[model samples]
Target: MKTIQVPTREQVNEEAQALFDQLQKRLGKVPNLYATIGYSAHALQAFLQFETSLNQGAFTGKEREAVALVVSQVNGCNYCLAAQTMAAVKRGLTQEETLLIRSGRASDQKMNTIVQLAKSIAENKGKSAQNLLAQFFEAGYSEAALIELTGLVTVRIFTNYVYALTAIPVDFPAAQPLPYALQEQPQS
Candidate 1:
């Protein structure tokens, strides 16, 4: 049987190798999920470009990380949760803030709207976000910002599904369990 394995930079095509080198220089390591994507050079390049473009959109780094955290948590993707939790901290979110965002709220009203919208979209598969969308705009987000936030959510879902499909080793520190997961059960 063929076991799934994340490819090394050397195992991929020239294009993917270059992208791996870039990731190494920028992040100090090529994350396992990205390495698995390197199996298809075109996919790795496209995913990287999509992510980089979204980074230039209306959301600040902290806001983007917040969206990532909430969406990943909603999708129950441990890999993305772990990675985004670390990114959230780097973006200046404290551990408490990350936990709160994962639970679909934030202390800042504007961010609460963002997290609630992201969570609603993920939980409803984007089919039921109307109310949250209205709240998002009322919270002072522009149409352009909405587009950017949606793009952020889409990218996070892509990574989350990738982790689901591949079950690649999470290279970052594990995220703490969500509050609901930690609740003790009654004695059977």
Candidate 2:
């Protein structure tokens, strides 16, 4: 297995350094994904900052994670599948729900809308079909929620695409890959 290329702390630029420090303090270590993004520290810092605020903002913690998991599932991002599965567990997501969502099979009434909307957003790249948008509204979500949903997906797309192109390693545990993802074959 190829190891993740983590820029040495000293090697990361000033912007990346601050983000790394904060992430270390918050998560105890910079995750492999974060390290990979360190190659473009400014971009990584901006993304992380946006991620932090988004996760802490409008959506409930579980909802934020749910959107992330569902988006990763839609994008067939195996690394995020593992990473988000762990995050979902930490957020107290039920094992059954997490498994279901990770597999693109969330069926609970509460999550149905967000899960579906997230998939549509990912599938359609944010111009969700009109009917799908209606479902989002019918689920009691305002246009603002949909907007937030879109923003969440925007964040994931950047990271997921980066991971795909870079074949970034997963320093975290091997998570169950999304049920039907293309084979997860991360390289150096």
Candidate 3:
């Protein structure tokens, strides 16, 4: 069961209410994740801010989606995986591109650079590998853009951990996990 109930548009506060209204207006419904995050107004505001900024990231639409997809895969967050996949497709990623990011291997030569860097950063928990950061910089992202990407990743971690705890039903099918593959098993 969810630790927090997913309050309907009416159940949310008049002050915290705008978040609900905005979500419904933009996404047609409040995501279960957002509803739960509404327990704290700051949490909900942070999520919305990060989401909007990341959506306007320095990378092109597809490039930003690729970064999101790679982070979702590494985090092993099925909810994020599905949500981002849907966003990626809507942003014009080919089905093949989506699969590649979900699988942690980009088939597109140009995109492989971004995917590898994003994966390395996620795996390292933001203690970014120096060489990889250099590579990401060399690939043309500015320092400011890198900061924005970190903000984006942090927001994702918030959602990913929430799902791990709640196991909430993914309202967006794009949030599913990649196909089963070699992954570390929890030790007894």
Candidate 4:
């Protein structure tokens, strides 16, 4: 097996070095996955720009984090599951609520709608069911908000796919295993 090393702060280019400094200042450490992205400074910068743009969108931090958790879970990306689980907690979701969101359910009705839609998008490769779209709008999401939600799902999917491909060693604490019932099984 070819092992792709995670670049150290010193190993990265000047652009990635600046990003590492900023991330270290803000987050107290450069996450290993971000460091891996630093292997390509352009990609690292692009990822940061895309992520920052999504943060400025209509979805609240909690809602975005919920979507991230659901998408990560559906995609079986352990790195994102760990990172987003921590993010969900920081955004005021209880551990149980985060777990529920990862399972494609939520106690809050609006959040449940968002979670279902996010899961649908991730599972179906952005082709959500029409009824789910109806529920998303009926749950008081505007068309613009729907678009923003899709953007959030898109960004999360990018991370999920990258982490899945790289099998990057997770820097965040591991998330608890999903309940057996919530685990994705092979289709017949």
Candidate 5:
């Protein structure tokens, strides 16, 4: 079987190499997933820009990480699961809280609403997300926030599919498997 190898900094074009330098400086290393995207200079820059812009938008870092955790879980992207698990912790979510979010709920009502909406959107591909959309607004998210949330989900889906396609090595520490209970938890 053919394998998609993660590109090395030296293997990419000048444009991607420059981005790799910036990523190395900023993050101490280019994550394998990002490195793989570096194989496409345009995609690497575009993804970095999109992520930067979204990070500056409506959600707090914690909230964004929460939504990412749920989407990563729903999509079964081990790369994102590992990366977002660490990011979620840095954003102040406890490991326990991360697990709960992965299961599509949270102890905090507002965050619960957010993750539930994320789960529904991911699972149903937006068609069956109406109830959760209503709940999202009722939970005090603005229409603007909804747009940002969808953007977040869309980017996550992109990366998830990248992992599915490439099977790139996860650069971050492997995320723990969800507890059996959470693994079987039914989505609301």
Candidate 6:
């Protein structure tokens, strides 16, 4: 099997270099997934723009991280699962709560709805059932929030697929493996 090389900050073009410098300043290092995108500066810039825009949207930081956790779990992307687990902690979720979110559950009713909807959207490829959509709004999310949630799911999916394709080395601390009982079985 061939390994996809993650580009070093030194190896990327000027645009990517600037982005890497910024990322390093903020995050202390360029994560391998972002570095993979750095191989195409335009792609890196576009992804950064898209992600930053979503961060400014209707979801609270914890809610957004919840969406990311459930989506990453559904997609079985360990790289994102690990990264988002850490991000979720920084956003104030207890490690146990993060694990529960990944398993499509949450102690908070509203967040449970959000995680379930994100899981369904990702597992079903954006073809989530109407009842799930209704539940999201019934839980008090606006149509605008739903739209933003969909966008967030799409962004996470992009990174999930990228990491899956590249089999990139995870740069974050390894998340605890989802217990077998918590693992979602593949739909037949």
Which candidate gets the maximum TM-score versus the true structure? 5
Model 2, range 8-49, lDDT digits (tens) per residue?
778888878887898899999988788878878888878987
Q: What ranking of all candidate models by lDDT puts the best one first? A: 6, 5, 4, 1, 2, 3
Runs of candidate 1 with Cα error greater than 4 angstroms are: 181-188
TM-score versus the correct structure, for each prediction: 0.92, 0.86, 0.84, 0.93, 0.95, 0.94
RMSD of each: 3.1, 5.5, 3.5, 1.9, 1.7, 1.9
Best by lDDT: 6
Per-residue lDDT tens digits of candidate 3, residues 23-142?
889999888888877767778898888778777767687877787788877877887788878889999887767877766567775477677777777888887777777877887788
**Per-residue lDDT for 1-188 in model 6, tens only?**
88899998889999999999999999999999999999999999999999999999888899999999999988889999999999999999999899889999999999998899898999998888899899998988898998899999999999999999999899899888888877768999
State model 6's lDDT: 0.92
Residue-wise C-alpha lDDT for candidate 1, range 59-160, written one tens digit per residue: 889999999998998888999999999999998999989998988888999888888888887888776467888888888889998777778889899889
lDDT of each: 0.88, 0.77, 0.75, 0.89, 0.90, 0.92
Which 10-residue span in candidate 3 carries the lowest summed lDDT? 176-185
What would the per-residue lDDT of candidate 5 be over residues 56-169, giving only the tens digit for each residue?
Answer: 998889889988899999999999999999999988899999998998889998888888888888898865457778888898889999889988988898899999999989
Using alpha carbons, what is the TM-score of model 6?
0.94
Evaluated at residue 50, the lDDT of candidate 6 is 95
Could you tell me the TM-score of candidate 2? 0.86
Give the range where candidate 1 is weakest over 10 consecutive residues by summed lDDT. Answer: 178-187
Number of clashing residue pairs, candidate 1: 0
- Checking candidate 2 for backbone clashes, the offending pairs are none
Q: Rank the candidates by TM-score, best first.
A: 5, 6, 4, 1, 2, 3
Question: Measured by TM-score, how close is model 4 to the native structure?
Answer: 0.93
Runs of candidate 4 exceeding 4 Å displacement: 181-188
Higher-TM-score candidate of 1 and 2: 1
As for TM-score, the candidate ahead, 1 or 4, is 4
